[model samples]
Target: MIPVTRRIAIDERELSETFVRASGPGGQNVNKVSTAVELRFDVAGSPNLPEEVRQRLARLAGRRLTLDGVLVLRADRFRTQERNREDALERLLGLIREAAVPPPPPRKATKPTRSSQIKRVDEKKRRGNVKGLRRGRIDHD
Candidate 1:
């Protein structure tokens, strides 16, 4: 099981891992060995996650989620599959952990303060005056 937070957990079976060749740092072995980890998790239809969490996860997942609602993460920074696998799981947990907390309360609607409005007007007037002064002197009528 993967623990997202104290309240949220996911089954390890929910995650799918595929290994492929990793580019960079391994020389010829890089081309031959499949060490990169491609981790996929289905967020939409998963039974483990709450509806609200699923919704948040979908929106928060960005380009990582495929059209079929599978969350895809590529872990190639490390050379070994085990390291890459852990890295992928860490990223998944990080993402889920970020979304575990409730969002901030909506701000109350507010009108502009009279003093602030007046200040804004005064600043605009000052700016206009500065701009107006830049014009060359007008010819006598």
Candidate 2:
């Protein structure tokens, strides 16, 4: 079980992981060993998550979430399989923890005060007057 928060814990069975060959830096070992870990979690179907958290997770996952509602995370920063696997799991936990947080309150709608509006108009008029004074008067004889 993966504990996301004080209230939320995810069952280990819900996670699926696959390993594939990783590119770069490992030389000959890179070609022979599969070090990259692909971790997948079914966010939409998870019984562990609250409905609100699920929605937020979907929004946060963005391109990482598949059409089938699975959240896929790829870990290839480490050369060893164990390190990559741990990295993947840690990333998954981080994401879940983030989703567990409550969203901020919606911003209250506000209108400009009458005094502020008048002040803005006054400033505009002042600027206009300054510009008008810059123009030389033409003598129409």
Candidate 3:
């Protein structure tokens, strides 16, 4: 099980990993080694993550979550495939950990103070006077 938060744990079986050749700047290793780790988690089908967490995860994943509800992450920074795999898993854990946090309650809206409203109007009037000076002579009077 991969621990996301203190309360949330993910079953490793739910995750699927595929290794592929990494693109860009790998030098000679770019063509020879398949070190890139593609980790896919089915956010919509996973029973391990709670519904609320899943919803938050999907939102937090943004572009990572595909139309089919798969959250895909690519890891290729490390040289060894094993290290890249671990890196991918850690990223997944971190993402879910972030989503597992309960969001703060919505704040109630309040009207501005009377003094603030008066100051805003005064500022607007001052700005108007400053710009009014720039007017052409045809309208200057």
lDDT of 1 by residue, 1-141 (tens): 777888789998899999999877888889898999999999986898888888888889999999999999999998888999999999999888877777999999999999999999988877777766678533322
Order of candidate numbers by lDDT, starting with the best: 2, 3, 1
lDDT for predicted candidate 1 compared with the true structure: 0.88
Off by over 4 Å in 1: 109-141
State the lDDT of candidate 3 residue by residue for 9-111, as single tens digits.
Answer: 8899999999999887879988998999999999999988889999999999999999999999999988889999999999999999988888999999999
RMSD of each: 5.2, 4.7, 5.3
The digit string of per-residue lDDT tens for model 2 on 1-141 reads 888889999999999999999988887899899999999999999999999999989999999999999999999999889999999999988888898899899999999999999999988877777776678533222
Provide the TM-score for each candidate, comma-separated.
0.75, 0.76, 0.74
Error of 1 at 91 (Å): 0.0
RMSD of 2: 4.7
Q: Give me the displacement of residue 118 in model 3, in angstroms.
A: 16
lDDT of each: 0.88, 0.91, 0.90
After superposition, candidate 2 runs with Cα above 4 Å error? 109-141
Q: List the residue pairs that clash in candidate 2.
A: none
